[model samples]
Target: MLIVSGWIAVDPEAREGYLAGCRRVVEEARATPGCLDFVLSADPLEADRITVYERWASDAELAGFRGSGPEPEQTAEIRDAQVHKYRISAIEPP
Candidate 1:
């Protein structure tokens, strides 16, 4: 599996717009094939900061999503976003 973690900084005045865009992206992403999970969260300490967590079946699946440009509006709303993708061996037991 592939796991992705990221942070996005948004303008304070554009926070609502950013979140609306994010919701659209998340909905579309969740419907994509091989999308195991997709989540977005706001930083408790920083209202303008957003965090992302996602799991995909494989790197190829992720690449396919990226190639398809599924979330153009949301992608554009983010100020400075940094993402890290990792190959996951397992998920921690709950």
Candidate 2:
């Protein structure tokens, strides 16, 4: 399993607009095969923060869905990000 998780920072006032623009991405990702979960959410205490989390069955599925990542215009909106990918070796009850 592959897990992609991180947070991003944008202009406080522009945060909502940035997330609103991701509705399609969220919907499409959830519908894709091998996608276990995908989400982009606002940080309750941080107006400039957006939390990102995604789980995929494999690298191929993630790559197939992610293609080239955010569009240029959207990429330009982000001021910073701290995201990372993890390869899970085992799973157990949480």
TM-score of each: 0.81, 0.97
Look at candidate 2 and tell me the lDDT of residue 11. 97
- Top TM-score: which candidate number? 2
lDDT by candidate, in order shown: 0.81, 0.96
> Per-residue CA lDDT of candidate 2, range 1-94, in tens?
9999999999999999999999999999999999999999999999999999999999999999999999887899999999999999999999
Best by lDDT: 2
Candidate 2 Cα errors over 4 Å, as ranges: none
The segments of candidate 1 whose C-alpha lies over 4 angstroms from its true place after superposition are: 68-76, 92-94
Query: Which 10 successive residues of model 1 have the least lDDT summed?
Result: 68-77
Write out the backbone clash pairs for model 2.
none
